[model samples]
Target: MDCLPLHTLQTVFGFHAFRPFQEEIINRLMAGDDSFVLMPTGGGKSLCYQIPALHRHGVAIVVSPLISLMKDQVDALRENGVAAAAYNSSLGERDSRQLLARLHAGELDLLYVAPERLMNDSFLERLREIPVALFAIDEAHCVSQWGHDFRPEYVALGRLRGIFPGIPLIALTATADHQTRNDIMERLGLADAQVYITGFDRPNIRYTVMEKRKPFQQLQEFLGTRPDEAGIVYALSRKRVEEVASKLRELGIEAAPYHAGLADRERSRVQEAFLRDDIRVVVATVAFGMGIDKPNVRFVVHYDLPKNIESYYQETGRAGRDGLPAEALLLFGYGDIPISRSLIESGTNPEQVRIELHKLSAMIGFAEAGSCRRGALLGYFGQRLEEPCGNCDLCLDPPDSFDATEEARKALSCVYRVGQRFGAGHVIDVLRGSKNERIRQLGHDRLSTYGIGAHLAAEAWGSIIRQLIHRGYLQQDLANFSVLKLTPSALPLLRGEERLVLAKPRIKVAEAKKEPRRRGTVLNMEYNEDLFQSLRALRKRLADEQNVPPYVIFSDATLAEMAALRPLDSEALLKVNGVGVQKLGRYGAAFLEVIRQD
Candidate 1:
């Protein structure tokens, strides 16, 4: 029992060692202590609890918010030869009864459930009758109202400690800021839990935010280089989801739409297809990506701006979950700001609205940032990167910044002259001296700042306005039809006491670049391409035969290891990184046959 974690890691999960903070967190949990884990997506958040659950006495109960995630994790665990089961609303009566019987009989290693189900009195009584090992709560941020994906069901989880006093509990989340983290701890009543924030930086993901220039065309161009790769495209509306999905199909890409507007069965089908790799791309809204566990998503493209940085980070975090090189492309324009603002303002909670607005501003700052994108992103999470990440758009080809003091002043003056109530477009029109009838009718043409900005084009002025908004000089008042309002901070700029240096809007071509190297691989090792492809084909065949995703069989990194270290027999094959005892018995023969042929 003392060596169970190491045994499980090597014989079941088939990893050489634990990731940075996993071993520590697992040890604490196995010691019958509560814990809080803040690891990024694909950072092995599951293993921290799964391994401990195996090490503990009774069945480990994992509270997850999404049914899809529950099934995916349970499937992956079973694939690793762990006796795991998921009980949720999706299960039939007979299935639920059998699972409950299994729980009573203590025949399961792990049991995944929803937070709502865990709060039931009958469930608590049933749990009390059995010796529960520990409670593992995934997506713990859902307990905090300040979190991006707030679910009311999560609030009831506070009773877990009160109900099962001696059982250890672990709360896990991939995204949480300082405020949200505090709220999560207080809400879950994990005051004495050992908190581990493993870091927010996903170095394998390359962040690229582009101006939305012909969005569909831009999307097609972005997808041109990633043929047959799995990814997600997020739009702002259901209409856009359908439009993008239809267009992707027209272009002969295997794509589908998933949103709240779709029927539950249709949505389930789409999600299952995606998990099975039947669909390579999913065009969706914000509703699509909370609990997905697909490991090999190669890219995540934001067709519109996400309302807050948390949402953006969580959405982008869905990619590269396999610890491979992934891309996050955000196609933003001024129009997206208003749409996101309106969505945020429509929410019922005032305090929540204010917090969301502030987050939106920070997200805009990331989009309009001149420096490192990763720096700004991680800075928001309270983690500082010492240097440029060298993977984002700015680090790859640094954008130039211009001293736009006069231009900013001119833009602010124009907003002020237009009664400070016009949106960016109307103000841009006034600044650029457009011969529009509305400007003439409003007599804004007579203002001193009317044509003062004509030296710059309307697009240029719009860029300046966006930059001002990002820099805290101006606030887009969604309550006032998204009119530009000068903040008190803008006084310094208006008084000519501050200079504004803004990054110039990038002009990009549609050509593709070379693919980035996958992370966690030895770059210096020369591999036989033929052998790698052969192994991949075998993996796909095995995955298809098992009716599971390819990565479930073995990750590309595992296959690369197999290709580089071609072993002759099972004894040598078992020495590979991902080949645990179970996998060696299940898949070693077929894979060894390929290597032996080579």
Candidate 2:
């Protein structure tokens, strides 16, 4: 039970590195201690238990929530020559027997099972017969009853140590708000465990929020700007998921829908398709994306507002997992406020529902705030920043405002003249002097200020209406899909007693600009870096031609080797890990030609 061998395991795992606090967590577990790991997504949580399992005798039991995640991790480990197996409901009785026999024989280093199966009496008996190395609970936050995703069976896991006395246990989660953290310890019986909390700051992701009128058109505008980026769009309902998926397909974006309502096999297919990059955007509900392992997703957009901030944080975390730049865009409005309130109000216990509603309200406040979105988000997570982060929508595109005492008075008067029963579009038409049939139907043409503020464009007027909602000068009637309704705060602007300054929303795209810097560890090579890129381009070309994954021809390791060695002929190239005689003869010349051009 020690980490004297962990340094070797790092190299064995094919990672030239580990994150800052990985070893600290591993060392605690190696010493037969308990631990609660709260690292963010893609923060090297798997290695904490996988490496330690190799050091101890017998198999380590890894309880995972998703069979897909289990299979992917096992496949990846086996590819790197590690022995792993999964025993879940998916396995046939025969396969389960064989897997159990293999476990008894100590043939597997790690065994992944679902929490339901882990609680089986026969499974526990089989496990006890074999010397248990350790027990790992992935997605441990689900064990907390107070947590957003509480699974009933997870409470039983806290008593596992009593069943296998002296065996170590580790709990890991990508998200645990303060309440969930406390619940995890109490429910999992890890009160004495060491806590490892990687702070919730993901500086690489620039958070942006926008208020929308026609969501479908706005979605197209957003994706059309970054067609090359891989992203996900989250809807609130299964019907909306399918609708958005269809719309994106019509717009010529490769997209798919994934929800629990889909067939299990179809769901698996979509999940696998996304992992293989066969689809660029997955329009899913909150029902999807818990244990997903896709590391290259470049952005995450919420077509509808999430129920709470913790859900928002965890789902957005799936982006930029590879430590690359990413974006999180949320489209929300006052309609989402009551939707969350209804969901919370309908829960079983009123007190619990009220508590959850409070959390949801905080999320709504963060979404609509005029301050920096990141600052509000960090503050909700108990983090404080003395200065505003210059990356959010408020900082990057500072809203433009003029002394709008007159404009505010005119807009409010238009709403009042129309009796305040209409939506934003109607309000904007009256202000912009667009006397269409709808305006005539409402008899809004007779208003005194109807054509007085025709100086502003329709888009400009839309920006004013949204900003007014955000600044509390006006409120939206959610029952009317957020129709314009003046709040008490609107009186000052109407009376010319106070200056009202509101800025137009940003309607632009960010350019893809990168600063030059050296990559992670330079191999000792003389080949031009541009030529190194050329080889990679050819590898992708060959992979597409052969209809196989690029890694099958050459791994990143092999590419780095080529960049270091810059081999001249087949003899030197054949020595690379993935370069058998077949690879050298089949695809060697194209790579060599690119290197020679350097």
Q: Which candidate leads the pack in TM-score?
A: 1
- Model 1: lDDT to the true structure: 0.85
Tell me the RMSD of model 1 versus the true structure. Answer: 6.8
Quote each prediction's TM-score: 0.83, 0.72
**Stretches of candidate 2 above 4 Å error?**
1-6, 399-598
Computed on alpha carbons, the lDDT of every model, listed in order, comes to 0.85, 0.74
Tens-place lDDT per residue, model 1, 19-112, is 8988889889999999999999988999998998888999999999989889888878888888899999999999999999988999999999
The weakest ten consecutive residues by lDDT in model 2 span 509-518
Question: How close to the true structure is residue 202 of candidate 2, measured as C-alpha lDDT?
Answer: 80
- Give a tens-digit lDDT track for model 2, residues 1-598: 3446445343345344557788888777777888888887878788898887888777889999889888777765665456899988889999988988898888999999998889899888888788888899999988975567778887888778678868889999987776788878887778789998877778767788877567898789878867766788998889999999999999889999999899999998887777665788999988778877666577899988888788899889888765656788888766767877887798998657766765675576567555456766765554555566776777675655466667778878887778888877788888888869978886788888688878988766766665565556666543244467777778877877788765544453232233332232234334455655667677767756755444445554466567767778777776554455445666778777765566
| Candidate 1 least-lDDT 10 residues | 506-515
Query: Which has the greatest lDDT?
Result: 1
